[model samples]
Target: MQARLDQELARKGELIHRWSEGSLHEVDLIEEDYFTMLAALNRKVSSLRESIASLEGTPPPRVAPEELLANWTAGSLHQRRAILKRYLHSITVHPPLPSSQFDRAPLVKTRLAPHWKTAAEVTA
Candidate 1:
């Protein structure tokens, strides 16, 4: 993806060079095409970077658990969601069967994020 972005950037540079040299007759059309391609390439690069970041699972900046607890209490919904996404890989909820006793509790499981697993292994 990075290579593709680099290639597209090089192509854009070449297009501009041609336009500057007055070699391209349809300058307006070429400019339009170049910008369109650049926008799409930029979006692709951004998406690729996000995917790489997720896969790498680099730990977030170190903060005290107390700080996080405070944030959870005072943060906006968006902020809270961001924090949860950073720390939790997933949550699975299993509903109780209708035939099961009413006293039985539903099953809930939570998986920590990849970074947490790495930290745990290091500590162990």
Candidate 2:
């Protein structure tokens, strides 16, 4: 709704340039400007809603784990040598998942927070 209004205002130069030029109710623009915009935006929104409704009833795509690993192994070689260099950039040992026994946050906090300065801090 807000987006449709914004589109209408964008197309109507009267609304855009109204401040200095000062013509809010120009006869030609007021008659056809905002309505045309609302119609087009309504169509777009209707189609997007229809797509969402259709997706709600559809099953998602699936990948087999063995196939994924095989594809990755084969495709990695065909990729540019630059990618090989990039892929070997670093091997990092991230902290284990956060745990009451091991860390300050929940066990599922798998990501490290920024500002961990020392290798010792991470390794600890």
Candidate 3:
């Protein structure tokens, strides 16, 4: 990413140099492209910094799947729902097929949190 950012910055610099030399045409288009690339690189760098900071900081608490499952099974509906909300990004419900009965396994698509994935892998 840093290499890509450097290459893009160089290209932007070249564009400016060409403009200064009066050899480049389509000033408006070039300027727009330059600003767009700059903004995108800025966002990428900021996100990268945030990711680095998060990884460098203390790790999150690790939970065993069995313990978590036990808690989930013991919890009330509201508590279970809260746990799901905490660990899952989204749960999409698809419509049943014409010939099919209500089967939740195929009807629901769940996206889980990244940390939960890591925890599961560690336990595995």
Most accurate candidate by lDDT: 1
Residue 52 shift from truth in candidate 1, angstroms: 24
lDDT by residue (42-103, candidate 3, tens digit) is: 35544554454467774433445764674465444654775676575554454455655655
- The residue-level lDDT of candidate 2 at 109 comes to 48
Pairs of residues clashing in candidate 2: none
TM-score of 1: 0.35
- For every candidate in turn, the CA RMSD to the true structure comes to 15.6, 21.4, 17.2
lDDT of each: 0.52, 0.42, 0.51
Q: What digit string (tens of lDDT, one per residue) describes model 2 on residues 2-120?
A: 46534543543343355225464564456245444434543454454445446675432222455334334433243333233423444354667545457655534444333323433
Ranking by lDDT: 1, 3, 2
Weakest lDDT window of 10 consecutive positions for candidate 3: 109-118
**Stretches of candidate 1 exceeding 4 Å from the true structure:** 1-61, 104-124
Models ranked on TM-score:
1, 3, 2
Q: What's the CA error at residue 44 for candidate 2, in Å?
A: 0.9
Write the number of the candidate with greater lDDT, choosing between 2 and 3: 3
